[model samples]
Target: MIGSVANMLAHVKNCSKARKVLIYIPYSKFKFNLLLAFERYGFVKRVSLLRYSTNRSEILIELAYNGYYNMIQDIVQVSKPGQRIYWKKKQLRVKHQIGTYFLSTSNGIKTNLDSTCVGGEVICNLV
Candidate 1:
């Protein structure tokens, strides 16, 4: 069972390389919420929830691009199964690079720019 966040994100990167319009991914609350934040940041287009089982669902993610070039140049997982990394509001004050920081905050998954309250685990950096 490939359920790790890193594993799931790898699939997304692969889809971007393939230049697919849309891709379906196994849904987790964290991943779903993160994708919503991505949508807000213009990294993705549309998102639709697809119910498969009582306890399981899937998300159809419409990718975004710039004139055939994949918008997401890179996606890197920071905190992982072995070593976990956490960040704070002050730590995130630094301006992110071409992409943004997706963090688990008190409110929910949010980009560093949008995060106000104390930040939690640093999930992934999206470029």
Candidate 2:
């Protein structure tokens, strides 16, 4: 089994740094939702289902860029397989003024600012 979220984020960050126009990653529900969250933040220009198969599927991600600068500065994976991080509702305040956080809450995959009343595992943060 693979850590899909971490893998997806790493791929995105690497592609962005390389100035790649598109990236293909193994598809999964959580990764798709996380990509949607990135789209909401305008880090990804587009996210679409590229290939479908019973064995292995893929997601096509278009990296967002502004001229010579990449839209995504960095992606920090907070929760790893070995060290999972969780925060209570009261602890879910906006710790950073710049970046936004994506969390897996009971309400589904939502940003820290969105589902504050409920706490969840820290997925990743975009900076």
Candidate 3:
């Protein structure tokens, strides 16, 4: 599970870079929440669940693109399995106009722009 989160981000980035319309990833609640956060911030066009072949589940992510470029420029994981990073609401800041910091707060996974975000683990920075 150490690389699960990183794998999820990689899948999205690689698929987008390859100009794919959709990508599938093994499903987990944490990954689903992260994808939802990405969709809320317009990084992904849509996200849905798929169940088939002996109840196995997968996530269907629709990559959002603008002409030749993808909506997600890059995803940098801040909190790793061995080293988790946490920040307060006041400490959270986004330095770039197109950048968004995703956090795992008490309420749920949320982007830095969420007015009600309380802050928890610094999941990743999305650009």
Candidate 4:
């Protein structure tokens, strides 16, 4: 299953025409696999783990693109749901951008939007 998914991503990477790439992985294990796959294909310029939270077992990846943003976006959109929890005790309806990275935890969605960044960040620090 992983191999097939990787192969599909490889296809997307091949057809990409953007200058930078942004790969978002809500789970760390899957993120590692993605990094490895990109590295193996020599398609990624740079990779970074942007956000981390103990409450949620997930990771957000930011990949620098050379000319494949649109392609990457297409692939990301079709990826499976990365939410770690099926339900939350304290449900919070937080606004999130199309490509913004986040992880859903057991506690629920926690964010501070009254500061620097809108939707600041969702920290699911419950489980």
Number of the top-ranking candidate, with lDDT as the measure: 3
lDDT per residue for candidate 2 within 40-76, as digits (tens), equals 8788999998655677788899998898999999999
- Estimated TM-score for each candidate: 0.89, 0.87, 0.90, 0.31
Q: Can you tell me which runs of candidate 4 are displaced by over 4 Å? A: 1-20, 57-127
Which residue runs does candidate 3 get wrong by more than 4 Å?
94-98
Cα lDDT tens digits, model 4, 34-120, are: 454444434444445544566554333344454533324344422243632332322334454343232322322222222222332
Q: After superposition, how far is residue 8 of candidate 2 from its true place, in Å?
A: 1.6
Candidate 3 local lDDT, 17-122, one digit each (tens)? 7889989999988999889878887899999999887569999999998888889888888899889998887876545445788888888888788888887888
Ten-residue stretch with the least lDDT total in model 4: 118-127
RMSD to truth, every model: 2.1, 2.0, 1.9, 15.4
- Deviation in Å, model 2, residue 100 alpha carbon: 1.0
lDDT of each: 0.83, 0.82, 0.85, 0.38
lDDT for 86 (candidate 1): 90
Ranking by TM-score: 3, 1, 2, 4
Clash number for each model: 0, 0, 0, 14
- Report how far off residue 35 is in candidate 2 (Å): 0.5
